[model samples]
Target: MLLGYFSLFASGFIAATLLPASSEVLLLALAQQGYKPLWLWLAATCGNTLGSCVNWYLGKELLRFQHKRWFPISQAQLAKAEIQFNRYGSWSLLLAWLPIVGDPLTLVAGTLRVRFGLFLLLVTLGKGARYALLLFLARQLW
Candidate 1:
């Protein structure tokens, strides 16, 4: 039981970050191993959101310290992301599930000082919907 929870958390965290982890793989593995789907979904969602929040916090800190020189990110890129984030607002987080761009979007949201409450709400909705869709597809295909 504990192992299952740990796996879900790890999967969620890695999925939210720039790493190439797959939460669906872990989810399906756990489900095939007899874990409860509802609990797994909740755990995965909470862990993913927390991981995304970590990225947001890092973005805030980066802006605070002006650490662009040390990081690979350039000011021009950040500026473009900022403009898009500003135009889209928290709804931009809807793309939080997209590959490659999702992680950066979270950071941009924080850098833009998007409302924390709205950020959480949008991230939850986007991430939750993503996992739910994956679950449905898994059921249909597997």
Candidate 2:
């Protein structure tokens, strides 16, 4: 049981990182194997949320690299991001469960200096809802 939870946590963490991975399958596998749903959900949610926090920290470090000539990001991109951040508002962090954009959203939240408390709240809600829904759907079919 401990091993199962650890696997989910590690997979969830990696999934939230730049690495190309998804914890969904492992989560479902555990569910089907009769693992406790609540523990599984919490493990995945916390791990994934922590992983996004890592992105947020990296975003905080942007000031150190933005000035370097080799920096991949340009000033125009930064400006555009600032504009979008204003347009979307921090509430957009609620969509942190989304696949293609979720990771970047977390990073942008930190880069734009969105309140950490709000970031954690929204990320946890989004991730928790996703896992809850996944488990619900699985139980429905089983």
Candidate 3:
């Protein structure tokens, strides 16, 4: 049981980050093993959200560091991200479900000092909807 929970949490965390992991696999495995779907969904969502928060913190720190020499990111990229961030604000987080750009979008939100409550709300909604959709598809396909 503990292993199952850890698997759920770890998969969730990795999924929220830039890493390429599939929490769906974990969910399917757990479900096949007879775990509760509701619990699995909640655990994965919460854990993934927390992991994304870590990325947000890293983005905040990256903005503060501003050491172009040490960091590989170019100033132009940062500036562009800032411009988009300024224009879109937290709403950009809706794209948090997209591939590649999704993880960085969360980081940009923190770098721009977006409101935490709004960030959480949008991230949760986007991520939750994504997982829910995935679950639905899995149910349909399986």
Model 1 segments beyond 4 Å from truth? 67-71
Q: What is the alpha-carbon lDDT for the whole of candidate 2?
A: 0.88
Which wins on TM-score, candidate 2 or candidate 3? 2
Structural similarity to truth (TM-score) of each candidate = 0.88, 0.96, 0.87
TM-score of 1: 0.88
- Candidate ranking under TM-score, highest first, comes to 2, 1, 3
Q: Give the TM-score of candidate 2.
A: 0.96
Better of 1 and 3 by lDDT: 1
Query: Which pairs, if any, clash in model 2?
Result: none
Q: What is the C-alpha RMSD of each candidate to the true structure, in Å?
A: 1.9, 0.9, 1.9
Measured with C-alpha atoms, the lDDT of residue 73 in candidate 2 is 85
Tens digits of per-residue lDDT for model 2, 1-142? 8999999999999888767789999999999999999999999999999998887787778758888999988999988887987798988888887898899888888888888888899888998899999988998999
- Best candidate, lDDT: 2
- TM-score top scorer: 2
